[model samples]
Target: MTRTTSALVVESAGAEPQLALVTLDSLRVNGVLVEMYVTGVCHTDLGCMEGYLPVQFPNVFGHEGAGVVLETGNGVTDL
Candidate 1:
């Protein structure tokens, strides 16, 4: 089943970040779902928010993070 959660989203260039309700699809084949407890805001995330990166808006930021594995999809053997 799909799940909904709060996420930091960039809706437009040069706009402030906003908290948005996002829908997450169920785990796919060989996919894993992580419940992030701690996340870091880095230079890249700042760049993306400042339009320095050629990234699409309404995108989720913060690649540097640590989280627990909440679910694993089919054929996923490694944790």
Candidate 2:
């Protein structure tokens, strides 16, 4: 099943961040799906949005976050 979620995406340099809808198809063998409760945007995110940092467009920022594990993929033993 495909899972859909909303995220803050930087579409381009010098552009405002956008609320984007994203879809997840499957997880890696050792990956776990997370349901984020709180997220924080840092200086890196700002730099990326302002073109100071080299990054691909439509990238998801906010590395500082807290979340709960919703599902674990195959071969994942510890939760």
Candidate 3:
């Protein structure tokens, strides 16, 4: 199955974050999909956006977040 979702994307170094639509692949076994309700961008993200970090372009950041599990795939035994 195919799915689409919105994401904050940085097209390249020094590029501002933008809301973009992204596709999703079928969930793998034990995979989970989360809908983030709370997220924060720390200095690390800012550094990347400012081209101070060595990370590649066209990145998806914001790992500091909390979310609700919307779906769980096969082999998932606990929430």
- Clashes found in each candidate (C-alpha, N, C closer than 3 A): 0, 0, 0
| lDDT tens digits by residue: candidate 1, 1-79 | 9999998888977788789999999879899999998889898888888998899978888989899998899889877
Could you give candidate 3's per-residue lDDT for residues 1-79 as a string of tens digits?
A: 8789999999999888899998988888889989888899999999988899889878888989999998999999997
Q: In lDDT terms, how accurate is model 1?
A: 0.88
Error of 3 at 60 (Å): 1.9
Candidate 3: misplaced stretches above 4 Å? none
lDDT at position 21, candidate 1: 98
TM-score each candidate. Answer: 0.89, 0.85, 0.81
Write model 2 residue lDDT over 2-39, tens digit each, in one string.
78999877788988878889998788889889999898
- Give the alpha-carbon lDDT of every model: 0.88, 0.86, 0.89
Order of quality (lDDT): 3, 1, 2
Residue pairs in candidate 3 whose N, alpha carbon or C atoms collide under 3 angstroms = none
User: Looking at model 3, which ten-residue stretch has the lowest summed lDDT?
Assistant: 54-63
Query: Which candidate has the top score in TM-score?
Result: 1
